[model samples]
Target: MRLEQKYTALLGDVQRRAIGGGVPSAIGQLRLCFEALGLASAIDADCATRLGRHGLSEGKFVLLSLLRDVPEGLSPHALAERAGVTRGTITGLLDGLERDGFLARHADQVDRRKLLVRLSPKGEAAASTLVDEHAQWIASLFADFTPAEMQLLSALLEKAWRKTDRGAA
Candidate 1:
């Protein structure tokens, strides 16, 4: 069977199981899941567009954000960990950012074998602007949620993320 057919079959099985149980509505749960997915996609698209306006992509944003918080800068391995990207990917990103006049790489004084990556003045200004823009965007997005609701949502999302992270590990 095709991928869609397999997915539908699995969903149908879950729906049947839910219906057989005391649960009132599996359709509502499915609808909520799809809605959340749609919201996530929209947010990702908006983020990509905003980052692109600054001549950066999501990966670059992650790298720049990490650098913004660290004055001394970070090594490729440290950047990879902070950005949740591969070491090779971090290297490429640092190279591209450096070429674009957004960052610089220097040999680590303590560890000569490792290269430390730091943002240039231009990069720092760009990152600061992006951070402000993102903060405003996030505030607008969550404007409808009350403080309690926001806290609950944050907790729930963190719990789900932890579960997924554990499963992946």
Candidate 2:
């Protein structure tokens, strides 16, 4: 309700400015952007709550998920690339996950100077559970949407994404 009020107030301000021909076009775009932001925030909060139960942040969960099947493990560099994070960020994630006993790191067999990261048994189990639950949660959220509707929505989102993917404020 409060968010809706704010959205209406914003539209009112735009109209009051007498922006003329642009107002009609801007209204739809502005409304869509606001709704998208609200949805993103809601989804993020949901993910945080779910991850908190397992003592995992999104970053830690991503690492575990990546290593779930990688018995041989990956180097810190590889994980960083996979997760699209900096080396320092990857190191921190690995340190926290390792401390929690969710993953392990060891020197590479062929390259002793390099370390490889792998999931511990506990991490493997948690990853499986989390992935399954997350999938179910996402599906449930969209249960009311028909398949056709879902496709349309997805397509629209992709189109909208193209506009904001570069040089967007």
Q: Best-fitting candidate, measured by lDDT?
A: 2
What total of clashing residue pairs does each candidate reach? 0, 0
Which parts of model 2 have CA positions greater than 4 angstroms off? 1-9, 18-25, 165-169
Candidate 1 regions off by >4 Å? 1-25, 155-169
lDDT of 2 at 69: 79
Residue 60, candidate 1: alpha-carbon lDDT: 89
Candidate 1 weakest lDDT stretch, 10 residues: 1-10
1-169 per-residue lDDT for model 2 (tens digits): 2345677788678776656655454666777777777778788999999999999999998888888778999999999999999999999999999999998999999989999998888898999899888879978989999999999999998888777747254
Clashes, model 1: 0
lDDT of 1 by residue, 68-123 (tens): 86878888899999788897998889888998999999898998898888889998
Cα lDDT of model 1 overall?
0.81
The per-model lDDT (C-alpha) reads 0.81, 0.86
TM-score for model 1? 0.75
- Record all residue pairs in model 1 with backbone atoms less than 3 Å apart, i.e. clashing: none
